[model samples]
Target: MSPTTRASRRRRPAAVTIHDVAARAGVSVATVSRVLNRKTPVREETSRQVLEVARSLRYVPNVAARSLSIRRSHTIGIVLPEVHGDFFSEVIRGIDLAARRAGYHILVSGSHSDRNEMLEVLAAMRGRVDGLIVMSPDVALSALHDQLADQLPLVLLNSVAEGHTAITIDNYGGAHAMMRHLGTLGHSRIAFIKGPDRNADASERLRGYRHAMRQIGGRAADLEVPGEFSEESGYAAAGSILARHERPTAIFAANDAMAVGVLSAVAAQGLNVPADMAVVGFDDIPIARYLAPPLTTVKVDIAELGRRSFEAVIDRIDRGLPDQPRHECIPTSLVVRQSCGAATSLRRTKKASGKKKTTRQEEI
Candidate 1:
């Protein structure tokens, strides 16, 4: 317990810092930092030497210190109204992968479909993140316009909320296309399942269906059911649709979850798809192909939505806002599987064959 022995025992290993890495590599702390953060390109030899020194010293850059100096967290945030599972996760993966490629990390939170919760999350995230990306936001568009829109870089996905930059599929076009596919299938008395009323994307899709149905059949009354983007809502809607004495010949669910529910409802009523009643869904979810008849649905490139949303925020963060608010309307197309995307190919093939058959008859 001598004082000298105690002092020696109390001594701690020197914690490695960026300064140490720079000194060992014979470079400036800035150069060492650029190399470690991968912020800027480094000469091959210098990069190798710096990396070697950092590893030798067990060096790790302090992100907070770096952010403090740079005024950037090298991070973004994604707030969601409903981030169910597969769909949101894939979108997030796309955003994360693209962001990392550009040298950034992400912060994520869910809004639980609560307006107050969304407001709280946005308030809490204020001034912390470099940018924010929201999916299916529940905030008032006017509030976003007046108060928070210009505060930071913001991008919105599948949202009714307004943004300086936003990305979403053409739900109206996609829905109209789907309805036209059903029209060609001899489905005059088609049924429609509607998604949440407040959701801008769902509302546009419903409008598309109504308009397209009018084009084909002149009216869409008694041919639509309500849905809520969930299996339970689909099931409930399906039950009511089936209870009708004059049921629809075909049913187009607003989304795949509703289509699956329709499938169950159809089975309960002892009806087979494309035989007794054709069923179609939207979103082209991964499980769509595995269904009994495979759900014919509209496909939105959800990954691209996520990737583009991230890009939108990054662009805004780098450059000031555009003269006018930028609103990007992404394109969506019908996927022609046995359920829906394939409907056109099959009909075309059959028509070509029929034409050939008629030609042979004429020759004979």
Candidate 2:
């Protein structure tokens, strides 16, 4: 062959096959297939070796051929209300991590929190995925039941449906804990920025707030301001609260994003955080701790929620759905920081103890 022909042949390498992977990894062809397709469980070490060998050889599985033979799609569909926020990103990250390890791909779609849009997305995913993980807190369970195919395994995140696996955060518990913290700080006239009216998580948090307020003989109805879980809405709600004849001593935003806006609004009014107006939020997003005063909020393991939901769906896909549907509620914890005046209280305690002032340690 000519020099040019030799170079071209070298550049265009032959495709690596399953047989090649099995031979290199010292495993049977069936073992290689099992590991690559994840259709059956293989020994952990052997599976790892086969995958590593395949990767070293730059082997690519023929997904269409496999699907045709097995009647399965090695992909998981993830439908969420919105995908732009940090919370959603974290959740996706977790799901992706699990999916990759299980030799599956993910198809993510945002439904814009609209019923029609969600149904359309579901329709598009019909035959494209083996299972689905949906987070539609605004939609009713009955509507979802009517839309989804009965055979497709599904896991829900932050939503509940009968006869389906679900993973949800303890929104009510988190909100109630925050309320207790605020009450302990003697914040009776606390203002709350509510999330979307129909959202399940939002409703649960609102219920918690009301329940906690009632326990303390405080009126929740007068101090609540509507928000759409956006920074702009939070800022607007803060403005409304600040404009009132009797301003609240503290503001509790539904989530960290809104709390950020509340912080901005408070600053624009020439007020100091924790001192002039204590600010708290829920869903401690990554940036919550880095905020000016370091926001105190309810901590939810957002990524773990995604990972768990993915696992639940994959389990159903692999082992078939159980007679009893699984429902998991992830616990939330309180994260105390400067934003809620916790640091000030700590400093006072230290001063009284005659200890030098130190950086505040976050309480969980």
Candidate 3:
């Protein structure tokens, strides 16, 4: 309890500071800050050395302090309909890549088909993020515009909201192309596996299918089966299609997930793809190419879509851009594969068999 003993026992904090990191790396405090914030270019070797020193010293940046000083968190918010699927995952991967490159972070939330939920999510992110990218399948454009407009810098993905910066895939065009490809393969009796009723992309795709059916001038089977963009729905829809008095020569599912379901159902029924029923899907998911017969699908660059959406928000945030909304439509293309039956081979087979080309029936 002596005064000298008490003084010797006094503890000192071991917290690592930026100055410690800079001094160890032989760099200025400003250079350390720039390297940590990624706000300006630093020499590659110097940046590496500083990072190494920071790691050795266990220096953690004070994000709260930085945010207070800059009045920005250097973070972005993402509002999605769901998060578990390949589509959402790819989109998120793209967003993460872009955000990391620009020294930003992400806060993601799935609205789960509830408008109020989406609003709540947005409210939670009100001041936390520099920008937001939303994927709303159930919420209408007008509702989104009314609620989210001027609230923050925003980018709408897979849905078109008027007067907001938006990016959307060409669902209609992709569907149309799918139908045309099936028609070329002599699949006059083509069944459509519809997507979720609440999604605009689903409706647009359906419209495209119907439009293409009309143009093909055939007795296109008027069969439209209900689906919720789920594999189970796709399986059930396939059952419904098969139960019909006249089976379809081909089936086009709205998206690849459902298409996978249809493939499973078809296999369960001991039917071979293309031969028993040609199958095609949209969104060319990663699994498409690995399916039993490989899927013929509409290729949408999902990851690229996510990357561009993030970049669009960053452009608005960094460049001090105006609040005027912008719209961009990403294109789609058909990827021919065995499931849909090769058009050239089918024609050649028919020609070799000396079979007359029969006129298509108009069923749509």
Top-lDDT structure, candidate number: 2
CA shift at 20, candidate 1, in angstroms?
2.5
Candidate lDDT values, in order: 0.75, 0.86, 0.82
Model 2 CA lDDT for position 362 = 54
lDDT of 2 by residue, 1-364 (tens): 3222332345555456677787889988799999876977799999989999999989897677778888889899999988878989899999999999998999999998888999999989988999999999887757767567568898889988777789999899889889988999899888899999999999889988999889988898999999989999999999999999998899999988899999999999999998999999999898998999999998888888988999899899989766468998887777888898964443212224333222123552
Off by over 4 Å in 3: 1-60, 144-147, 218-221, 321-323, 343-364
- Predicted structure 2, TM vs. truth: 0.81
- Specify the poorest-scoring 10-residue window by lDDT in model 1: 355-364
Top candidate, metric TM-score? 1
The superposed Cα distance between candidate 3 and the true structure at residue 56, in angstroms, equals 8.0
Predicted candidate 3 versus true structure: per-residue lDDT over 1-364, tens digit per residue: 3222333234675356677777778878799999987877898998899888998889997777778888888999999988879999889999999899998999999988688888888889888998999999778757555557765788989887667788888888879878877877787778999988879889989999888888876554467888999999999999989888878889999999999999999999999997899998999898898998888888887888899999999988987757677887777767776788774232211223333221111110
**What's the C-alpha lDDT at position 351 in model 1?**
26
Per-residue accuracy of model 1 over 1-364 as CA lDDT, tens digit each: 3222322334575356677677778898889888877887889899889999899888877778778888988799888765657678878888988999999888888887666677778788876789888765345556445335647777778764533567877888888878877887677787889988777777888998999988886458777777888888887888888788987778889889888888888888887776787888888899987888777777777888888888888888888566445787766666656643233343322225431211101000
TM, every model: 0.83, 0.81, 0.80
Model 2 has an lDDT value of 0.86
Model 2: pairs clashing at backbone N, Cα or C within 3 Å: none
